[model samples]
Target: MLDLRVFENRELAQRILMAITREAEMIGREVRLMHVCGTHEDTVTRSGIRSLLPENIKIVSGPGCPVCITPVEDIVKMQEIMRKAREEGEEIILTTFGDMYKIPTPRGSFSDLKGEGYDIRIVYSIYDTYKLARENPDKLVVHFSPGFETTTAPAAGMLEAVAAEGMENFKIYSVHRLTPPAVEALVKQGTNFDGLIDPGHVSTIIGVKGWEYITTEYGVPQVIAGFEPVDFLMGVLLLLRMIRKGETRIENEYTRAVRYEGNLKAQELIGRFFEVRDAKWRALGVIPTSGLELREEWKELDIRNIYRVGVPKLPDLEKGCLCGAVLRGLALPTDCKLFGKECTPRHPVGPCMVSYEGTCSIFYKYGALF
Candidate 1:
């Protein structure tokens, strides 16, 4: 078992924060570090770390929430696929994590679609879909696979399993996005940030080598960080020191799990079952080679082909919603005209307020929507 005492106590966190604040003051320059993990955003807000930081240091939330970035068009397409199956008198089940149920689309949401007589089931994992496929051979089980590298390895493993067992009724709606390309896009957009606090879980899969481009090409310092408060503060301090010295490099603070080369077996599995393709994010549109598509050998399991469904286009968000700007880091959640007035977490007008890890939701929960 992992050592709980080291990270459970708050003393280590306090010490790290003190060091970071001291280093920030010595630099005599504003240090802005962006964290690309939603969980880290929650940790920072929940622990009140922002209030503790020096005035010269700023921590901004990046486009890290998977649910927030899921394009509305994709959700609408999945809903349409379910509707088409029902009209043809075929039994179809759409399974996904419970967090994805409330993510809104242009028309409505999966919850709304389920309320309109669609079979949308919530399963814990892809293996559960295989079990459901075995129980009901007559029904088609399409799992909505949405996540970063942390969750893609298991989905890749499940695909290999389904292929070995020759399960024709089971398939996955692939909406998986990679981390490196998204970071590259953020940098190319010329976001005025000094450094990046890289995603630790994703780094465990893709490794530190994948982030070399950010430092070499984009000239931004990045540090892979863990979820704990001490780990995060240390990462911040490292980035600040690097910026102070005018150095840009890829550093890994979470050395226990992440390595230079990462997990090759997982990478091989992903390459075997899927190929890189262009995908649309709700806020950031059509990033090149950011998404994964199923391989041609597994075309038989493609839900779009099996059900003969057409992908539909969705309209842009209603006016006065700054979710797009917030995701792009051009604006904060409080900058929205309807942030706390019309777009509370209870009645979110966009995906940003729907997910718990979303920046707007985080701010709303901690009363930071000033």
Candidate 2:
């Protein structure tokens, strides 16, 4: 068990950093490790932990922010779903995370629709969405849910709740993604990351064994870790050790929250309500079975299947904005010309800037530390 006190100890933290630095020297080469969790990036940036790192160590952020990676086509599809429902005289309520509300689509943002008298509500959790459904039984409740295993598990559980309650008014347009397929896609593309600092939240839901494919097939090492600076440093050290050992395998450094089998109930709910499908990421494009769609039996509970919502032709993104590249770890936030100039947190020109978990947003807030 990873005690919380150990992580909070400044002296212990210093020792971990010292050992990590020495290990970096021992490896004696440039090391690229990608962490595909926005929360992990936030911890690294906010804690000024990157400044304590050795020179040759680089930690890159991958497709971690759910809102930043959602394809423009899906956003357009969301727009169409709400509009068509209103056109057909159906009262509808669209609920999603606030990040999704501000994310720019080809047409505009969901916030734009909100301004035009659309009934789009920003919800903090699926339970809040359920409450909305129960209260407005006459109105069709559309939940536009998106995230990795962490968020997906809850969405799955919500579906189970709906089925148990015999509720037919609620429907979901799931843009949920699985990280393994995205990671594998990275390997297939010959991405240069030598190892992975996997997301701890996702691992807690999917378990450590879910990542076996990374080492077994892609021949890459992965270490799951929590949000603390020590956990992340430990994960990096594990990766370097794997490199020195000339071995590729998946290991867990976040055992305090994660286990080998994960949350079996959450996994059961997910397996019951969802199936794997090809999902289009912003820059990485369509990854094979990387997305979760409602199961065939749950087709009636799926808005896309019920309404036949088609993808709309999206408008071109802002010229010279590299949010796509930034999400894929190919380019840093500073690489974009408009990052701090034309695009800031107040007025974001791209989706990456809109998401608090986004690399651009993190860089904009704390790039000076790096």
Candidate 3:
């Protein structure tokens, strides 16, 4: 096992900080870097990395949090499934990650519906959801699956398992998304980012090579970094060096876990069970080929295919919420007027405030570190 403490060394962090300061001075211009991982945001905020950085080096949060960026339309569809089930006097259980349970919609949240005797469940993994289906053979088990590559692979594995066993009780409502396309959307839409910090967890599944297209086509530099303070700081330093040298390529700082080719088995599993599709995000509209849906062969196990829940058309974010801008890296969480006041983790007005991985929630919890 890797000594996790080595990655958190204070001495190394200070050295990198000094190097980052020097690089910022050498560059002699403002640099904006965006990272698309919730854990990266937590590391940046909780470790006080932002406060320690030179004023010219700014880190922007991207649509890293799956729960935060999950379109409200998908949530409404899940609710619609429950509502329709209730109307027909059917007992169906809705399962999702804990982070996804409290995401608010116009019709309230899964937690709210759970309070009102809806069969909503918080599960840590797809296996737990599968277990629910096995335990209650009579009830329909619907998993509201939403995530990037890291979580999606396991869902595929479970689906394969379900198919092999001929299990019909469990179904998945796949809102799984792809990280590369969203990054492409940000680049294509002309988001002002100098460099990209590829997410460590997602890269572990997709591999470092998966993000090469961003640099190959857009001439943008990227670095895959872990969630540790040193890992992030090293990624920033690598990006700064690339930026200064006018180099456009990907560097792997989290090589201990991530690789150039990534986990082939996981990638194959994902491809086996899912197909690329255009999907909606909370703030960013429909990004082309940015989402995953179950393959036609496995459509029987898909919840969206099985249920005809009428999803009402709804706006991405609530009125006056800047989550859309935040996700696009156009604004900061603090820039929102309601960030600390009206929109909080306790009572989120927008999707960004609801999840711990959300930028607003991280800033609210650890902004005091600054």
Residues 138-242, model 3: lDDT tens digits = 999999999999999999999989999899899999999999999999999999999999999999999988999999999899999999899999999999999
Top candidate on lDDT is: 3
The top-ranked prediction according to TM-score is 3
TM-score of 3: 0.98
Clashing pairs in 1: none
Which digits, one per residue and each the tens of the lDDT, describe model 1 over residues 65-179? 8888888877888888888877888768999877688887778989888898788888888888889998988888889888888778889999899889888889888888887
Models, CA RMSD each: 1.7, 1.5, 1.1
* Clash numbers, per candidate: 0, 0, 0
* Candidate 2 TM-score to native: 0.96
Residue lDDT tens for model 2, 1-370:
5368676577878898888888889889998889899999888888777788898988888889988888889888888888888888886799999888998865888999999899999999988999999998888999999899999988988888899999989999889999988988988987889899999999999899889888898888999998887788789888988987788889999988899999999998899999999988876688998999988999989898767677755643678889877766788888899989999988888888988899899988986875
Off by over 4 Å in 1: 368-370
Candidate 1 CA-lDDT value: 0.84
Query: What lDDT score is found at residue 34 in candidate 3?
Result: 97
- Ten-residue region with minimum lDDT total, candidate 1: 309-318
| Decreasing TM-score order of the candidates | 3, 2, 1
